[model samples]
Target: MSGASNSGAALGSLLRQIIVWVVFAAVVVVLPHLFTSGSSISMMSQMGVFILFALSYNMLLGEAGMLSFGHAVYFGIGGFFTLHAIRAVNDGVFSWPLELMPLVGGAGGLLFGIIFGSVSTRRAGVTFAMITLGIGSLVESSANMFTDFFGGESGISANRVTEVTLLPFSYGPQIQVYYLIGAWTVFAALLMYLLTRTPLGRISNAVRDNPERAQFVGYNTTMARFVQFALSGFFAGIAGGLFAIMFEIMTASNVGLIQSGSVLLMTFIGGVGVFFGPIIGAVLITYMQTALSGFSEGWILYFGLLFVFMVMYAPMGIAGVIVAHFAPWRAGQLHRLIPVYALAVVPAMLALAGLVSVIEMGYHLSLAYDPSQPIDLFYMQVNVTRLLPWVVAVVVLAVGVALLKWVSGRIRERWNDINKTTERPEAAR
Candidate 1:
C-alpha cells in the first residue's frame, strides 16, 4: 500500500508538471493570435531564442558557478554554421528539414565547447574567464580575417524557406517561424530542466557550491566543469541557429563582445540562482530591446540604469524578488507588507521620473538629430537647452533621493518585524 501510494503521488506530481507546461505552450502558440502584429511576432520569436540562450548561460552561472565572458562564441559559431547548412541544403547538397537545422547549430557549439572547455576548464574563477575572453576575441577577429567563411563585415545571409517541408510551412511568414521557435524553445527548456535532475547536474551543483569539497569527495572538478560547459554551449548554439533562421543572416557581431555582455546582463538581471530566472531575464530584456528602441536613442542608457538598480536593490533579479514574497504570502502575512510597499512606491516613481528626465535631456542636447527638439516627459514639454528645465530635474532628483532613503528605512524595519514575527513560531518549535 505504501509503495502504491508513493507511485500514485509521483504520478500526480508528474501530471501537474505536464499540465503547467501544456498551458505555457498553449499561451505561447496563441500569443500571435492576440497580438496579431508582424513586429510583435518577430519580437516574441527573438524572445524565444534569447530564452534558450539565457537558460544555457544559467547552467554556467547558476548551476556551476562559472562566470563566462565569452559564452557568445558558441552561440555565434553555431549560428554561422547553421547559415552555411541552410545554403548547402538549398543548393541540393542534401535534403533536410528546417526543423532539424538547430541540431547542426548544437553540433557546432559542442565541437567548440570540446575545444575551448578543454583549455579553459583547467582553471577556475577569473583565470577561466580571462581564457574564455581571449578565445572569444580570437574567434571574433578570425570571423573578419577569414572572410571566405564569415563573409566579411556584411555577414552571411540565407533563405530559410529553401528547405522542403510536409506541413506547408514555407517558414517565410513570421508567425510560422515563431511557432517553430516556440516549439523548439519549450522542448529545449524541458531538456534543460530534466538535466537539472540528473546525477551530473547534482554534482555540478556540488562543484559550484564547494569545488574543494567536491574534489575531496573524489569528483574531478575540472571534468565536471567541462561537461557542464559543453552542455551549455550546445544549447547556446541551438539559440544561435534560431537567430540565424529568424534573421536569415549571420555576422561577426553575432559572436562578438557585445552579445557576450548582453547574455550576461540577461542572466544576472533575471535572477541567476534559479532555474527559470534566465527565462524571466530573457523575456524582460527582449521586450525592452524591441519596445524601447523605437522611442529613444538612449534606450541602452535606460536599460543599463535599470539593470544597475536591479543589481543593487533586488540582487536576486526580478524572479527572486517575486519568489522572496512567497513565504509571507503562503503564511498569510503578506498583507503586512502592503502599506510599506505602498509607501515606497511614491519615492520610487519620483526617482524614476527625475532620472528619466535627466537622461532624456542629456541625450537631446548631446546626440539628438536636432538638438533644438524639445523633450516630452509625463505630458510636459521641456527645453533641454534651457536652465529652468535643468534646475527642475536636479531638484526633483535630490528630493526623490531624500524621500527614498527615508521610506526605505521604514520599509526595511517593517520587513524585519514581519519576518521575525513569522519565524518566531518555527524557532520555538
Candidate 2:
C-alpha cells in the first residue's frame, strides 16, 4: 500500500513538471505575437541567446565554484566556427538545419574547454581566474593574427537566407530566427538543468563546497572540475552559435574582454547561488541594453550605478531578494514590510535624482553645446547651470543618505522583532 502511494505521488510530480513546461513553451510561442516588430523580435532573440549564455556561466560560477574571467573565448570560438559552417552550407558544401548549428558551436567549445581546463583546473580560485584571463587575452590577440578565420577587424558575415535547411523555409525573417533561438534556448536550459541532477553535477557541487573532503571521499576533484568546465564551455558555445545565427555575423569583439565582463556582470547580478537567477539577470540586462541605451548617452552611467546599488544593498541579487521575502510572505507578515519598503523608496528616489542630476550637469558643461539648457527632472525642467540648483541637489543627496541610514536601522530592528515573534516555539525552546 505504501509503495503504491509513493508511486502515485511520483507520477503526480512528473505530471506537474510536464504541465509547467507546457505552459512555459506556450508563453514563449505567444510572446512574438504580442511584440510583432522586427526590432522586438531581434531583441527577444538576443535575450534568448543571453539567457543560455548566462545560465551556462552559472554552471561554472554557481555549480563548480569556478570564476572565469575569459569565458567569452568559448562563445567566440563557437560563433566563428558556426559562421563558417553557415557559409559552407550557403555555398552548397552540405545541407544542415540552422537549428543544428549550435551543436557545432558546442563541439568547438567542448574541445577548447578540454584543452584549457586541463591546465587551469590544476589550480582553483584566483589562480584559475588569472589563467583564464591570460588565455582570453591571448585569444583576442590571435583573432587579429588569424584573420582568415576571425576575418580581422571586420569579422565574418554570412547570409542565413541562402542556407538550405530541412524545412523549405529560409531563415531570412527575424521572426524565423527568433523561433530558432527560442527552441534552442529551451533545449539548452533543459539540458543544463538535467545536468544538475546527474552524479557528476552533484559531485561538482561537493567539490565546490569542499574539494578536500571530496578528494578524501575518493572522488578526483580536479577531474570533476575539468568535466564541469568542459560542459560549461559546450553550453556557452551553444549560446554563441545561437548568437551567430541570430546576428548572422561573428566578430573579434564577440570573444573580447567586454563580452566576458558582460556575462560575469549578468551572472553576479542575477544571484550566483540560484539556478534561475541568471535567467532573470540576462533578460533584465538585455532589455536595458536595447531600451535604456537609446534613452541617453549616460545610460552606461545609470547601469553602472544600478549595479553598484544592487551590490551594496542586495548582495544576493534580485532573485535572492525575491526569495528572501518569500518566507515573510508565506507567514502572512509580508504586509509589515510594505511600510518599511515605502519608507526606503523616498531616500532611494532622492539619492537617484541627485546623482543623476550631478552626472547630467557635468556632462552638459563638458560635452553639451549648451550648458545653460534646462535638464529634465521627473518631467520638470531644472536649470542645472545655476548655483542654487547645484547646492540644492547636493544638499538633497546628503540629506537622503543620512535619512536612509537612520531608517535602515529602524527597519532592521523591526525585522528582527518580527522574526522573533514568528519563530516556532518548539524550535525556540
Candidate 3:
C-alpha cells in the first residue's frame, strides 16, 4: 500500500508538470495573435532572447554559485559567429536552414566557454569573477584590433530571408522571428530546468554550497565548474544566435562590459534564489528599457532605484515574494493578510507617484535642451520654473513616506501572527 501510494503521488506530480508546460506553450503561441503589433512582436522577441541569456547566467550565479561579470563574452561571440555563418549561407558557400543557424552560435559560444572556463574555473570565488572580467575586457579590445572578423565599429549584418529555411515561412517578418524566439525560449527553459534534476546539476549545487566538501567527496570541483560554465555558455550562445537572427547585425558593444553588466542586473533583480526569478527580471527590465525610455529621460535612474529597493527590501525577488505566500495560502490563512497588503499598497503608490514627479522635474531642470519649454508630464503641462508643482510633489512624497512607515508596522504584526497560525499545524505534524 505504501509503494502504491508513492507511485500514485509521483504520477499526479508528473501530470501537474505536463499541464503547466502545455499551458505555457499555449500562451506563447497565442500572445502574438492578441497583441498584433509590430513593436509588441519585436519587444517579445527581445524578451525571449534575454530570458534565455538570463537563465544561462543563473546556471552559474544561482545554480553553480559562480558570479560572472563577463558572460556576454559567450553571447556576443556566438552572435558574431552566427552572423558570419548567415553570410556564408547567403553567398551559397554552404546550405543550411535559418532555423538551425542558432546552433552555429551555440557552437561558437561553447568553444570559447571551454577555453575561458578552463582557466577561470581554477579559482572559485572573487578570483573567478576577476578573471572573467579581464577576459571580457580582452575580448572587447580585440574586437577593434581584429576589424576583419569584428567588422570594427560598423559591425556585421546579414539578410535572414535566404533560401535556406526548414520552416514554411520566410524568416523576414518580425512575427516569424518572434515565433522562432518563443519556441527556442521554451525549449531552452525546459532543458535548463531538467538540468537541475541531473547528477551534474546536483554536483554543481554541491560545489556552489561548499567546494571543499564537494572536493572531498571525489568530485573534481574544477572540472565540475568548467563543465557548468561551458554548458551555460552554450545556452547563452543559443540566445545570441536568436539575437543575431532577430537583429541581423552584430556590434562590438554587444560583447562589451556594459552588455555583461546589463545581464547581471537582469538576473540579480529577478531573484537569483528562485529558478523563474531571472525570467521575471528579464521581462520587466526589457519592458522598462523599451517602453519607459520613450516616456522619461530618467528611466535609467528609476531602474537603478528599483534595483536598490529590491536588494534592500525584497532580496528574494518578485518571484521569491510571490512564493513566500504559498505557505499561508496552503494553510487557508491568506485571507487574513490580504487586507493588510491592500492597506500598504495605497501609501506605496503615493510614494511612487511623488518620486516619479520629482525625478521628471529634476531631469527637465538638469538634462533638457530647453528648460523654458513646458514639459508634458503625466498628461499635464508642468512648468519647471513654477514652484507649486515642486511643493505638491514634496508634500505628497513626505506624507506617503510617513503613512507607509505606520502601515508597515501593522503589516509586519499581521504577517507574524499569520505565520504563527500557519506553522501550528505543521509543528503538530
Candidate 4:
C-alpha cells in the first residue's frame, strides 16, 4: 500500500509538471497571435534571444560552478559568423535558408569554446575568471581595431530578405520572425535540458561540488570543464545568431563586457543553482531593460542595488523565493493573503513610476538639448523638468517603501505562524 501510494504521488507530480510546461508552451504560441503590434512581436523575439543566452550561461555557472566573465567571446564570434552566413545567403554563396544560418553560429561558438576552454580550464576559481576576462577584452579590442573582419566599429549588416528561408513565407513578416525565434528557443532549451541529464552533465556536477574528489574517483576534471565550457559556448553562439537574425545586424555591443555582465546578471538573479532559474531571470531582466531603462539614467545604479539585495537577502533568486513559498501556496493555505499583496502593489507601482519619472527627467537634463523642443513629463517622454517633481517623488517613494516593508513583515510573521501550526508533527519527525 505504501509503495503504490508513493508511485501514484510521483506520477501525479510528473503529470502536474507536464501540464505546467504545456500551458506555458501554449501561452508562448498564442500570446503573439493576440498581439498585432510589431513592437510587441519584436520584444518577444528579443526575449527569446535573451532566454537562450541566459540558459547557456547557466550551463556553466549552475551546472559546472564556473564563473565566467568573458563568455561573450563565444557569443561575439558566433554573431560574426552568423553575419557572414547572412551575407553569403544574400550573395548566393549558400542556398541554405535564413533559419539555418544559426547553426553556423552554433558551430563557430563550439569551435571557439573548445579553443578557449583548453587554456582556461587548466585552472579554476579567480584565475579562470581572470583568464576569460582577458580573452574577452582581447576579442572586443580586436573587433574595434580590425576593420576588415569586424567591419570596424560599425560592425556588420545583412539583408533580411535572403532566399534561404525553407518555408514559402516571406522573411519580411514580423510574425514569421517571431515564429522562427520561438521555435529556435524551444529547440535550444530542450537540447540544453537533455544535456543536463547526460553522464557528462552528472560528472560536471560532481566536478563542481568537489573537483579533487571527482579526480580521485577517476574522472578528469579538466576534461569535464573543457567539455562543459565548449557546450556553453555553442549555446551562447546560437543566441548571438538569433540576435542577428532578429535584428538583421551585429555590433560590438552584442559581445562587449556589458553584454557579458547582463547575461551573468540574468543567470545569477534567476538562481544559478536551479535549471529554470536563469530563464525567469532572463525574462524579468529583459522586461526591465525594455520598460525601466527608458525611464531612468540611474537604471544601472538601480540594477546594481537590486543585485546587491538579491545576493544579501534572496541568494537563491526570485525563482528560489517562489519555490520557498510553494508548499503553502500550492495547498491553498495562503489564498487569504491575496488582498494584502494587492494592496501593497498599488503604492509600490505609484512609487516606482514617480521614481522613474524623476530619473528620466534627470537623464534628459544632462543631455544638451534645444530649448525650442520642450520635453513632456506627463507623457513620460524626455523632459527638462526642474527639481520639484523629483523632490515630491522622493518623499512619496520613501513613504510607500516604508509601508511596503511594514506590511511585508506582518505578512511574513503570519505566514510563519500558520506554517508552524499547520505542519504535521510526523512530517517533522
lDDT of candidates 1 onward, in order: 0.91, 0.88, 0.92, 0.83
lDDT assessment of candidate 3: 0.92
Instruction: Please say which candidate is ahead in TM-score: 3 or 4.
Output: 3
| Clash number by candidate, in order | 0, 0, 0, 2
lDDT of 4 by residue, 1-429 (tens): 999999999999879867866776786799798976888888888888899999999888999989999888888788888888888877887687888878988998999999989999999989999999998888888887877668888899887777667888777888888888888888898789879889999999998999999999899999999999999999999998888887878888777788899999998899987788998998888888887677655778778867997998799988887887777776567776676778779677766767666565666667647532456666654434555666776787787778778777877877776687558653777
Distance (Å) between predicted and true CA of 65, model 1? 0.6
Q: Residue by residue across 176-293, what tens digits does model 1's lDDT show? A: 9999999989999999999999999999999999999999989999999999999999999999999999999999999898899999999999998788899999999999988789
Error of 3 at 105 (Å): 0.5
Per-residue lDDT of model 3, residues 48-78, tens digit only = 9999999999999999999998999999999
Error of 1 at 190 (Å): 0.6
Off by over 4 Å in 4: 1-14, 330-332, 336-343, 346-354, 357-391, 422-429
| Candidate 1, residue 84: how far the Cα is off, in Å | 0.7
Which residue pairs collide in model 3, if any? none
TM-scores for all candidates: the values are: 0.96, 0.93, 0.97, 0.87
- Local error of candidate 3 at 47, Å? 0.8
Indicate which candidate wins on lDDT: 3
